[model samples]
Target chain A: MTPSHTAESARRSAGDPPPAELRSRLLGALEGLLAHRAFDAVSVIDIIRAAGVSKASFYFYFASKQAVLAELVRQAVRRGHEAADPWVSPDAAGPSDPVEGLRQGVTDGARLWRENAGVLKAIVESWGSDDGLRALWLDQMNSFTDAAVTRIEADPEALRHLGGVDVQATAAGLTWLGERLYYLAAAGVPPFDDQTVLIDTLTNAWTATLYGRRAADGRPAGGAIVDGHEGR
Target chain B: MTPSHTAESARRSAGDPPPAELRSRLLGALEGLLAHRAFDAVSVIDIIRAAGVSKASFYFYFASKQAVLAELVRQAVRRGHEAADPWVSPDAAGPSDPVEGLRQGVTDGARLWRENAGVLKAIVESWGSDDGLRALWLDQMNSFTDAAVTRIEADPEALRHLGGVDVQATAAGLTWLGERLYYLAAAGVPPFDDQTVLIDTLTNAWTATLYGRRAADGRPAGGAIVDGHEGR
Candidate 1:
């Protein structure tokens, strides 16, 4: 029924019917409700009244208020995933250093935060209380961490040069930093012009700090190579 | 007044009823509510019911749910400040050395987090939904940042070895890192076992990264100058 609720129609039974426009209107109204009032304060009565949809329609799409919140969290995460553009995976690379995978991960991570800040905020805001949403967050961030670790460990040459880098810890630390910075940037932290600057600064610092390497003269140097293969 | 509400009688009217017990109950109830539910989900009724206090008692202590949350944030901040053990202010010192100030700040910072993790989490969780809370977080975090900047600028001699440490940016960066790590540690981030470890690791890495030096390969290094004056 509504443009925003496109997926709702797809889930309806073959014989069942609700106009797409009404579905979209309901979704948009929910968004407006949440933006203006605390989610808990919003009632089903309030929702249907605002959407101009029947209570029957409300039940058709959602099981309960909690279900709506759950759906919101899911939509937020899905949007985050869609907005992402992490580093090219090591498996997909061609003659490139595997660590560039991490670099790409950092770049893509920053981009996702910038593009989907609202969605990200909704997810993180839910993290403290919503177990399912929290799990989703841990899964997504840990996946990135896992990918970084795999990239580091898979490259023998790169792993070899990491004499001091704690592969596991560093990966976890970077992922945590990215998640936190994502929130900060979404909240408009200064000196971070946009996600690009935030990503560059974080990746640069992370590369330098984790590797225990000094830049040539204090500025982040160009693509740092690991044993002349994977650039860390 | 619930027990917790009494803690802030100093901020309220002198003629206000001595609702000490009620204040405590309210604060304790708030703490429980925060632990169990998201900020937006926790309602005035929930807090009052949790405290086993009358609705009128709840209002007697707090103007609104937001008021309860605001007071909670303030109490948490005060607790954190009180938890700052051995944090010798630079002005409290015989002399000013930014490194010494920074070292103390780092140590104090870690100790504060280690001691008051729940408070830290409550404050952090409140940031996104509450503009006032976000401003408070930035101000509190930036105070630490400003301290680092002052120390860095004052103790220029201490940083002689660092050819180009970009004091201001480095201080801001380290402050951000410190606050970020505090949250991470509260959330059970591993490898950062205790306050000392976090303080030492973060302080060293911050200085090392800023000065283009390598972060040393050691833990638990809160050496002399914990007094802000070595060889005094």
Candidate 2:
């Protein structure tokens, strides 16, 4: 894996586009390195060595390690949107009780964080310092915020329940809330590190804030879910 | 301020300890630098030069720039606890409605973040890569989480309203939510950057999650606070 002259020989003979294959290898190597090392501690030299590519090839694909990190963050954000679709998508259908759909969505989102913890962690830790990374992060966050705002606004019941709370601000706050919780969960911080409890807590929060109070049976006033206790 | 030999003249002769003054100078220099540059960009040399202190004096007071950062974070967390007391303190007296106290606390917290934005930003950006900073950050977060849990558990009304939600985990999630929101506001991120909306949104989320549904008039079902519109 740590060879300098193996890039040409290691290429698969399966008619893979050479340039795309090399780029993928570099990306994969950086992602793999980030699993154990912080982005600051991981260098281009280390990435290429791990990718079994030459310095020239590594530069040909990426201007710097930060560039590769930006790409990883972009990919992760796209996957994050997909994972959140069950709850954030305005037309996505699910259980009659929307909170149950939310639970499922949050559950999937937590799993996504665990899988991409390395890449996400690097971006969260570095974005504040780098101009490009900061812009990219805020832009990605806005997408989630907009999706959440749209979903909530589309639900007249939820909208009526919100009262004086500004939808755009609340959506933005909730989006940041999810980001922080997922970051803490990925970093193995306590309470948040407990996945079951984390999901339950977030689902409850979302239900309460967006759907208003639940009845004694743990169902929203308008909800008729048969068994709230079954999932947890 | 940039003179190498000015540390001697910069000291206040008001019976302040020389060592303490020098340490404070170093800390202040680093904090000021952080406002303009990320921690990764601020070096020991930069700190000392800004402090107008010798390299040996810096090492004598603190082990590294990171050590100084740890101290700043500690100081900030202490101030944070004071700012949060109106809401998080179980025995703190307030308006007939507790949510008013929560609003005041959240507003103070936002101000605190704005004041310490530079130092707090540095910690958030570097903690993931530095083991000591990560531990310090997590420990400080746990203090907030514990206070939240204690406050929630003490309020039987709030407890009753929580339903199946786990208090400990909910407190942890809300604590991180506040941290993220404050960080974004301090960083001047949109939506959250609007202070009025930020405070109102957080107050609403806290009110709903901890106090359950508000009445049609915007007061929680359990209490009476006239004119919810007066503050906003």
Q: Quote the chain B TM-score of every prediction.
A: 0.67, 0.83
Compute DockQ for each candidate against the true complex: 0.18, 0.46
Per-residue lDDT over B111-167 for candidate 2, one digit per residue giving the tens place of the 0 to 100 score = 888889899988988887889998999899888889988888888888877766667
- The TM-scores of all predictions, comma-separated, are 0.66, 0.86
Scored by lDDT, model 1 comes in at: 0.59
Residue-level lDDT tens digits of model 1 in A124-211 = 6656656665676777777667766765676665455444434665566556666766677776765453554465456555655554
DockQ of 2: 0.46
Give me the displacement of residue B207 in model 1, in angstroms: 5.0
TM-scores for chain A over all candidates: 0.62, 0.84
Candidate number achieving the greatest TM-score relative to the actual structure? 2
lDDT of 1 by residue, B1-232 (tens): 5565544543345766564767887887887776655566778888877877778878888777767767776776677665442243445543254444456566667766756565567777666666676787778776666666555554544355333433444455566777766776667655455444455556555644555333332333434323322221
Question: What value does the lDDT take at residue B24 in candidate 2?
Answer: 84
